[model samples]
Target: MAKSEQTKAKIIDVFLGLTNKKKWDKISVKELCATMGITRGTFYQYYNDIYDLMEQIEDTLITDLNHRYQLLPLKSPNGLFPPELFDSKYDYSPPQELFVWFDFCKNHQKAVSSLLDTKNGDAYFVKKLKVILAQHINHIMDYDGMPRDGLREHFTKIFIELHFMAARTWLDSKEEDFLSIREIINLLNTMRVGAGFLSNKQMTSPDFEAKMKFPADREVL
Candidate 1:
């Protein structure tokens, strides 16, 4: 990596570390730079302000999750139809990448959750997540029978709602609610099913075992 990019990453790291330790509002650039052994000028070269760093962190987290999902060896639900839906290899199992994601969100619960409250309907994060889910569903299901635009709109809203709710819980859980990757993946799978974003064949995947898994428990969601 370039020295500039590396330095910027280190700065982000320092910011995230501090964020985990205290509220974002309480942490200052001076403290972050001091913790990272960087000068204030060096920090400025990478970020305009603390808000910029926060934005960067949020963007990076979502981007990383999407990228990781693309790399997963998911089996399309083309052949899995009703009565046994969600039986595809894409069983809601989160991969290694997702665990890292959970850790990040859990550590920065307050700051991250605050953003969700501020930017629910209009946030780029929510929009990007919609697009991500739409594309994935398109590949795994046959949406040609329905109005694509309508499906996208409905599915997006459901996805965002579930994600935000689960994210909030994951961040604020008092018990060992930190879910495994499979559990999170299952939660997502359930949401997609509940939103009616499945192919005819996918609607019968043996994985679902009769829509019995909808509205997963608190731990999974």
Candidate 2:
């Protein structure tokens, strides 16, 4: 990485570190610079203020996720999609490259928590998330019988919002409320089922069953 990018990343690291420890409204630019071992001037060279720094962090994350989403294969390879899944198959589990989105949140729990804060406006992060997610909606949703335009796009947007908030809830929850990844994936499948869009064959497929396995299912086996 270039010197400038490294400096900015360090500053963002400090910002996210502090953000996790305290309320977003309580975090300050001076603290970020102090932790980064840089002057306020150096900080300003890269960002206008704390919010600018926050937006930059969000944008960097979103752009990387968008890039990852782009790399995902449009359809499962000849052997990747099981013959058992057939036409109703949609890789609802996040695409392999986009799995980085999960890693980003896991590594930046505090940062993700900080973005969920509504003190300023969280719509910015949510909107950015929508863009990252919306593009891959087709990969996850069954499109064999549906048009790509109109209602399809609308529900994809809604499902993106639902997925985002569900993820946020999972992040924000304590052990009691925590939603495991499998549970969440099952919830997503359930959502499709409820939408009257999921098919019986798809629901019963080995591909779906493989991805939807729970701990209990393993125990039973």
Candidate 3:
């Protein structure tokens, strides 16, 4: 609760508030400073730019997840995923000492939604996320047999992108009917199980793709 830390947090609050209202690219330094009631010099003292501020916010969340919440070292082989990472259904406050990504999202839903709107995380943030996910899904990806590097990478990529899509859909539409968290969980479970099955099966990629079709051989382009 030091003055400097408090000031920085207030700036962050204003920054996140702005993100909810506009694209991250559109929010300028002057505007954010005006919202914070601080001079540009003050902002510079703590952050280099808006991106820096956002990254710091992310860093703080990661720190809490790792140390305070103990969500770090995420369980693997189908461990620490949606619904499980989130608090109980329709709730935000995690059970005592139980923290997950949803806890942070609940607090900054608007801003996080904005950043995700950019889809930039697919390259940057998701790279960081994949590290955690890989540790957890690696076992499942090769459950039936040993997978080559390419196989693991390909499955991991799909897992991260699909999860992001599901998460984005849920965050954008908070309504229970918009997209059930259970459905998202099911999607993830499918990927986990699919990875295992594909590992054991001798079918080639083409063979697997051939079996997956849309009704008739009608292509909609």
Candidate 4:
């Protein structure tokens, strides 16, 4: 990449690093620029605002996940919800990506919490999930008798929104409630199957509520 492009990428890395250490409000563009020895003008040249950088990070993460999924031989019954999907063998374990993300949140707990303080964050995740799930469903659904138009869209939205809400709640919890990436994958599978994206037999165990709980030692009063 050219020097300017390289600088812009470095700026994004610095911003995400800081985001892990502090809240968004606590992050100062001036400081970020100073740390990287760049001027505010250079920062503005790349992004309209801090939130723009955030959106970029979110988009990049999603893109990376999609790319990772494409490389794996996910052809079996358990392929969709397999815990091994995040293993290091593929150079991109889902759980490791999640850990990196959650650790970023934990590092910048105060700032990250504020982002989730409103419905906007939740809504954004829901919308993104809806799009992803819709595509995934269409790729795997039994369409012979299935309604191929409006009903699929409706089901996709509702199921994705519900899963998005649950995921946000799990990630934003004060305690380290979500310990396993498999649990998250399983929950997502249940949501997809329940929404008719997959066959009923494809659904995992039904005791999802109990399974979604925090560790016994980490329970809050």
> Scored by CA lDDT, what does every candidate get?
0.59, 0.64, 0.59, 0.54
Question: lDDT winner among the candidates?
Answer: 2
Top TM-score hit: 3
What is candidate 4's lDDT per residue for 115-195, written digit by digit as tens? 444433334633564565566555444321233556666765665555445545766664466535466655655554444
The digit string of per-residue lDDT tens for model 3 on 144-175 reads 23345566677767766775676677788848
Query: Cα lDDT of model 1 overall?
Result: 0.59
What local lDDT does model 3 show for residue 98?
A: 17
Q: Give the per-residue lDDT digits (tens) of candidate 2, residues 58-137.
A: 87767766766666667643332443454455434434433555555666676676676545335668777766677665
- Model 1 TM: 0.50
Model 1 Cα lDDT, one tens digit per residue, 172-205: 5665757654577577766555444454344446
Indicate the worst ten consecutive residues by lDDT in candidate 2: 76-85
Candidate 2 deviates by what RMSD?
Answer: 9.4
Candidate 2 displacement at residue 167 in angstroms: 1.6
Q: What is the TM-score of candidate 4?
A: 0.46
Stretches of candidate 3 off by over 4 Å are: 1-4, 20-26, 64-108, 119-123, 139-146, 201-221
RMSD (Cα, Å) for all candidates, in order, is 8.5, 9.4, 8.4, 11.1
Clashing pairs in 2: none
TM-score ranking of the models:
3, 2, 1, 4
